[model samples]
Target: MGLESNSMPKIVIGDFGYTLEDVPHLSDFIPDLPTYPNPLQDNPAYSAVRQYFVDYDDTIAQNIVVHKDTPRGIHFRRAGPRQRVYFESDDVHACIVTCGGLCPGLNTVIREIVCSLNYMYGVKSVLGIHGGYKGFYSKNTISLTPKSVNDIHKRGGTILGTSRGGYETKKIVDSIQDRGINQVYIIGGDGTQKGAAVIFEEIKKRGLKVAVVGIPKTIDNDIPVIDKSFGFDTAVEEAERAINAAHVEATSFENGIGLVKLMGRYSGFIAMYATIASRDVDCCLIPESPFYLEGRGGLFEYIEKRLKEFGHMVIVIAEGAGQEMLSESLNQKDASGNKLLQDVGLWISQKIKDHFSKERKMTINLKYIDPTYMIRAIPSSASDNVYCTLLAQSAVHGAMAGYTGFTVGPVNGRYAYIPFHRINERQNKVVITDRMWARLLSSTSQPSFLSTKDVVEDSMDDKKETPNYALLENGFADAHK
Candidate 1:
């Protein structure tokens, strides 16, 4: 067997399908492989020999290589070696900007980026853009160094500051060109990624060679394909604290109910995870799962039954939940153009109060809590700090490798480059049929059929209505059956 210093070990075939003679030599394919500088040479964390190029034929089991279209578009392969970098460390100028609302790991990401670029790549000219996209044109920049961002990850929020609704593509591109920044890192959510795409297109239109990279920053964990977004773990952890407080307040009084509103405009991951973590929540309301207010088998009826049995109940709700139930027109939008959802927590509290006072002639104690901003402004958890570091490192690696017009995130359980168009293609919503939802339903023991279709079917049933007391005494399963 031929032994190469920086290549895969040669294996001898005995009774296997293929023999050593049948395999092609690596030298035949990569005769003149370029030698790239190894920054992490002293560190044992990274492998010395990196797989720079991957062959699709090598993944096939057959002896003959077939070049046919696969079902999933492409075969899986590891990233090749890092040889082509767009910027030279000594002369390159880079800018980092944050946009959208606050997330737990925003500062952590910024710190990691600056540290990696300064230490790993020896980049000297690092500038921080303040106030999101508007800062790009307004020329609000702060000089960054390894020392300046060393302790930023220990704090919450972003040192560069952040905002939304400033998407001047032309002016931003002009500013980038004027500053001679070859690489730009943008950290934000869906709207911010959209803005990055526009800025990238303008740069390309002007025939400029600027690499624009995005770090997917959303506490909602609504970005698709990726397993989870940074700061999401911290948000869920903090939201659990609010849920705990709500539980304490609810259980203190007779027939009391605690309602908590969490951040998740188009998704429900935060509410779902927080409810699961708290384990004391009796009901969970999310944007994906709609619930009814007044009916034979509705939320009000369920609450009445639970209160009768358990005396008190704790409920967690996403901000976007039950907006359709509200009669008021939703004409307002925030700086990022996201529709301002109705206050579902307050609405549910009021509805419960009105139903008990007028319909049942009973008094109900409900505590309304909105912990959206509180959760967003806090520092990141230990889990998120590690996640934010990996995300930032992967982003810098991709940006250095001459990859442009893409975002860096974990795809298929590995860190890889994802195009901006694919990142913003659609919103990632909670799958109602998935195991997560099933676990939530099993834990809370809430009515499974809060959906509109289920409510309509129940209303259309000609069977006699079961008594609320009987349903409470038995279980929801017996009542449904």
Candidate 2:
């Protein structure tokens, strides 16, 4: 929501029975900031729309589920083109930077951001910051236009390039101020968003008129406060190919086992979803559920029994799954300070082979397939392409409206402006007790592989970590109006 009828800005509540956490605005620091009519009103491209401007009090609910006793829940400022913007089209200068690992739809987001700025707002001076945050000082800036990014959506990876952990807020903010970039679009995961938040703080400390907008990007679908990240759909779609290949290999030989490793550093959505989608998978392992190798209710016993009955089976494991069973030396950290995970695929594969050959005195054929980089290096699926477009446009809209220190994403099917701290506070992990995980268990017929104590502990932990939008009454009408 953008325009204010009165000169005074609306009050933003930090937290009450309901949460109205709004993003920072230029008006928050600078008094009597000039407002310009949104260029979209005069653009022929938007002339066909009947109603375009978002209401000042419009918001998107974070949680749609409610009970009779539910208190007012969390809501976020809705994202869209506003009638009045804080920045004029002629004065606006924008730059975009991508960080962290490669993912599908990265290029699509870049292409759309450039295109939307030029076509919709008639703001043509868009710069692409090469590499990650270090790109501000170390790398060259390339001018981006609709013409330059026309066919980039068909490609994989980010055109701006990316790296891990080069966040120097002072240096980055200095670069922005020196270059006259009023709008900063950051595309990356939680770590990158954290850096974006710091950059916003530094920008504000200097009393500069800049808007920093983050578009959450992760193939893992692990970012919180959003329904799902952009490339997740494409990652799930591509995983089906690997699962099919594994099934083919496993079914070809007697006593065969197909081991497929998927990318999920902390979450298991990819492995879980792929197992459910492929139906041929006999077992799925993820970081959320612990599994043992020996004794009753162990993975070895289940695998042995399954092979004896069916002659062949497929096992899908997330990269982060079974980390507790790995060597302690593998528990290192990367440049981004994320724990370096050991290869669970190879370890489990060898263990299965050893158990069958040495313990059971039998020979078994096993094949392992790692499609981690393969999935990340491919272009996004059709659905993800459309999603990237929407996310890019939303970031542009928020920046133009002078909303700073915010990230744009679809929460409960509606796009909203969420503050950065909410996302980086914690990861969006897969709840083992959720019905979706139960569906995966049903599909694969895999044992929960969890002890009574583990289950109880997890349940208690979930209860302790209540969601931001919890127990809300029907205050949507009263809250907004």
> Which candidate leads in lDDT?
2
Please state the error at residue 86 of candidate 1 in Å: 3.1
Residue 35 error for model 1, in Å? Answer: 11
> In angstroms, what RMSD does candidate 2 have relative to the true structure?
7.6
TM per candidate: 0.83, 0.91
- Candidate 2 Cα errors over 4 Å, as ranges: 1-17, 452-481
Candidate 1 clashing pairs?
52-80, 52-81
Model 1: per-residue Cα lDDT over 261-362, one tens digit each: 999887899999999989999999887776677776688888888999999999888888778888895889987889987777787788889999999887
Model 1, runs deviating above 4 Å: 1-81, 450-461, 464-481
Pairs of residues at least 3 apart in sequence or in different chains that clash in candidate 2: 71-471, 71-472, 71-473, 72-473
- Candidate 2's clash total is 4
Model 1's number of clashes is 2
Model 2, residue 131: C-alpha shift (Å): 1.3
